[model samples]
Target: MKNLVYIAFLLTFTFGFSQKKTESLKIQNNENAKVHFSDGPALFFTNSDSLILQVHPQAMLIDSLWMNKLIKSPLYDKEQYMLGDDEILVAGLEELPTDLLKARLKYLNSKTPFKIEYNPQLEQVIRTYLQKRKSSLSTIMERARYFFPMFEEHLAKYNIPMELKYLAVIESALNPNARSRVGATGLWQFMYQTGKYYDLEVSSYIDERSDPYRATEAACMYLESLYKMYGDWSMALAAYNSGPGNVSKAIRRSGGSTNYWNIRKYLPNETAAYVPAFYATLYIFEYAKEHNIKSKERAISYYATDTVQVKRQLTFAQINETLNVDIEVLKFLNPQYKLEIIPYIKNKNYILTLPIKDIGNFVSNERLIYAYADLEDTKVEKPLLELIKLDDKITHKVKRGEYLGKIAAKHGVAESNLKKWNNLKSTKLQVGQKLVVYPKNTNPIVTAKVTPIKEDKDETTYYIVKLGDSLWSIAKKFTNVSVQNIKEWNNIWSVNSLKPGIKLKILNLLNDQKK
Candidate 1:
């Protein structure tokens, strides 16, 4: 009886320890599964039953399987103690093979989210997102580090939700120069008309839609207005994605379903996906550390900068010379100024962002800098008007069955000149190629004699046929001539079928000798 009791106690203790170990493994696996770090590759673990690792700063649990892999992989070296995978485990970060860690990160970053069970519709959408995400993540991570701080600052100033930062990630992946197929542009993806409504200047010289600071402020104001109308964050976000009109229509269709999910079915396809994508992105970013994704620290300079008001036109090149700074740095600071020319009209202040340290240097040498910039602008005078005039030349749309030579002859210009003006390398002319026929006068003036043709009152009016002309063209030669005229007068409409040297009748004839 004593032996049996002792055996029972031992079994119970073993079972309890086994349960605890399984529970620990589950927790670690969950932590390893999450995606983290906007810039680094995603990290994940395969075998949750092996070892345990923890994230620093937060001390989140990491799965042992991943830890073991990291330690054992080629990424880790056994000797000379590098920060490789082998040393990572030896460094007491985890008790698993370091080889697993390397594999886990690769898997996590590359893995697509689990597909919805028995739902083909949702699976298709998920697949598309995963495919697009593969290429997009790298670009987004690169640009986000530089832009996020400015975005956060602006959002905070407006008392807006910081989560709004994800909107840019969805809109253009933080690419300020992004232009959509439909012409929507910038990091926030504002259309031209909408951008103009928000006071974002759009011109040949500059597109303020690409200006990170200006566009963010505009987006915030627009979002604020939407929030005021909808009274719901989700609805406001939907309205922003698919316009307020569509959201209102959806609401009305759903019998006033204020919930996003309730009205999601009635929303536009992309808008429905937009909200989910936003939520997924927010979740991924929030839980990145758990996934073992390490962010590469980049010390961005110029965070502490002051904007100086300048009221004169200044080029970045000029600024570089005058301020003794790299032109590239100025470009990084002022991306809004396309052509690198600051339009500083008199009394209209252009805010120039400069490093705080350089503010003193600028103030002391303001006059000299201004003078130097003015001189540079004058010396490097661009023939902007001439370029515009050239662009404004008349265009001739090519018609069907017409070649370049025919069109050139019709417009009284050489084929080569037309090609040169239109930047065509070949003689091929498509049906709608807008061939430039007229160019600005760039030739010396020449005098020529003017002779007038003499009109014959009773003479036979005959039309001279030129190359590529046919007799059928004679019937349609005169505005009032009928097809029967060619068959009646010349007794041949078929023969008039567009042959060279085919003459047709006209009302009267004019002789140059008589004039």
Candidate 2:
């Protein structure tokens, strides 16, 4: 099978070669750390001897033939970022002469901290990407033109290596909505706790992790943080893929070798491939033209879109209904809003990114769009903490032997509520994960007959009214607090005259019930 050959080719190149029974090469600290062997182990290798290995292009090419006997999933089609997730084919690639490959790699001045080795394994991945995955590579290239400017800006802002921009391609194939099987989401594949640390809010209607611009910025910050922790980009990347704790353990296991290659064997299997994949991707992208790869036509140019702040809560349905803009494109442009609805709070800001041509239509008919229907009136899901205990604030630091269900029971809350409050897609918990608990309470009005929605007696929420927000709509958020209560709180006798940007304080308790 194609997979079998592919595995053989990779293993042969990456982890092959029998150790010589007598006087085999073994690598030691610093003296000959970079010595790479082609036929045997680098046991007892010292700086006094040569560390370079010469590989015949024809030999590798012949081996590549067996790996390309059959074509499997064009990895790009399934999900672009799943590296080594499918068959690798080099059958149709315009072969790069060994001398020319060495020449080109040397000629291309790369400015990354990670070592870009030109080995059979790296070449295998590059050739596979350029040949079998050419279509996907082209697509990624086209989209990169649209996304890279932002990536560069953020990378520069954080003083990170500009070459690190390719990380997004390897993380999510530039797809903002791309999610990993491990529940890491977005271009950077941030887990829920990591995303929360970066301040990417996830609610019923919005998930900022899928926002291209915001997520890129968060990724930059996170990468910079990792770099600070490890002081080496290669190790930082490894830590980024598999946490710093794992990398530290690997270092300890590798006898305290600071060099990534020396400690590479101790890293997780996937993580060992991670750095190589990144390097391979960087090489392919940098010399795409040399490999006869051309980027496909892009949907929009870098400046084709514009972002506008939404003064009020609005949905894709409402926007499409009024402005005639395709909601699908809106979703594509703004993938962060989980429900295609952007929530608006008076003191906070939310934006909708759309094509420049559509911005005019949106701005012109903003009022009609927000006031289009009663869709926003429906109750949206709140954070888990807000749905559980009635307290205003509670922090639960994960302890040993604690699970979500157990934690929920201890707090007298539902397990599902815990996940939502934490924006966790799974129940896996670390020993020290800090969870915020927003206590939920039912505050049914003690009225004669009409029982409205329940509220938390100890809590208060605020809202800002735009052209479309109304007393009736705002009242829906509370159990018994109605339009009368809103009018009384703000001293406003009329509803239609609500001014945009005016803050309204909402108390949770019904007036009579409180009394």
Candidate 3:
């Protein structure tokens, strides 16, 4: 009897300890994952891992959870779904009956210019959203309440189909500041060159691509142009994801087929999934009531907000204090103002947007607010840097042993931009090929002959982390340096470790560090 009692006590103690440990681990992980930076403006990372299916020049990498779910489903082997070499797979887990889905899709097809007829792939995408991403649909719907109106206004002006607003839903999951891994940014995921071409200005102090109104207008115009090129909305969407060149190639490869489904095998894998994802988002949002997806309550709407012109330079910090507006609300309203400072250059008036109630307060006390902002500016230790406007284009002639990376680095431009500007299909460059470049920096470093420095493998240097420094940006400052290399060298895996003034160890590189 004593032995039994002792064993019971031991088991209870062990179980209690295990339970506490598990709870402790959960709390610790949650804390680590949500480490907030209070020192400066918070960097809002996109809700991308859950939603966006990247469709860029490179092969698409999707969320592993979605991929795994598809792999386990019987729909994975369906011939009707053209699974790409890079695995364009998504299957709904028997959540909704096929007949019901087909009927709904038929309704949707009749309503939109897009060819949204029922297919196994389309059904899989819709079911996947209904099953796995149903919870997120509520939040997405709430955001749509704020953004869709603006999207619709512009779409109507351009005479584009109103349902085309759903494209933004999948492109960004309704996050205005969503940035893809390849540097495609904003709600529509516009590449730097594409954004520039659309006259969406990207300056140090402002990225108009993140501006809801401007970005929406740009998207409508671009979509309108694409529609003109390909007489089909589906084909236009395919061109939007993979460039028209790729779409044209696909059509040619598919024996002059203009239909998207006919050329699905020839198109990029990501483009194949892109149209279906958009359709899935449209279906979920359209039939949210049937799916029992409830929208979360949103306090603010685009209509409720109004803009006031700033007479002088104003910082969000100053405005937050003086107007008693939340800094986050100001950030949300004026996303174009990077670094949260509205510059007051002569003849270049930058507007400050605020809630309708706050607009009256701002306009009434404009002088006092400017006085307060001026006083605050005087108290600052460092004056904000002047915005570098990218206005000039320079031609770079490719020399022997020269590649896109080498040329781009020499001119201080992105390789993607170089490719886009020159319309080069691939990274390969022939000798004497001239590339037009809109350099971010007016003065690019001229390559100079360097003295060779013998270095030990153990020798390392430290980099002082700046306010806006990211691991990716830091890696780009050195020759042949990669983010992975920096991660391993500094033993710093988390972005939380990258606070200002933190010194990161970098290995010595050939040709020293980039100027």
Number of the top TM-score candidate: 3
For candidate 1, give the lDDT of residue 396. 85
Q: What TM-score fits each model?
A: 0.48, 0.57, 0.58
Worst 10 residues of 1 by lDDT: 75-84
- The lDDT of model 1 is 0.52
- The true-versus-predicted C-alpha distance at residue 107 of model 3, in Å, is 1.2
lDDT of each: 0.52, 0.62, 0.65
**TM-score result, candidate 3:** 0.58
CA lDDT for candidate 3: 0.65
Q: Look at candidate 3 and tell me the lDDT of residue 451.
A: 35
Q: 104-182 in candidate 3: lDDT tens per residue?
A: 8899888888888888878777776676565556666766776787788899899999999988877777766666668
Report how far residue 73 has shifted in candidate 2, in Å.
Answer: 13
1-515: candidate 1 lDDT, tens digit per residue: 32354456547645754434221111112232222111111112223342221112111112122222322222111111111122211122232224543344345334422211222333333333333343344334444566787788788887787878878877766656656657788778899888999999876546789888899999999988988898777788899888999999999999999888789899997788777666545534544455333333232332535567775677664564334343435555676776666786666556777655345456654654564444334423323223233444567888887766456545544344565577664344577877766532220122112233353557556766544232222333343333333333443312213334767555432221111
Better of 1 and 2 by lDDT: 2
Off by over 4 Å in 3: 1-95, 381-515
Off by over 4 Å in 2: 1-81, 85-94, 373-515
Ranking by lDDT, best first? 3, 2, 1
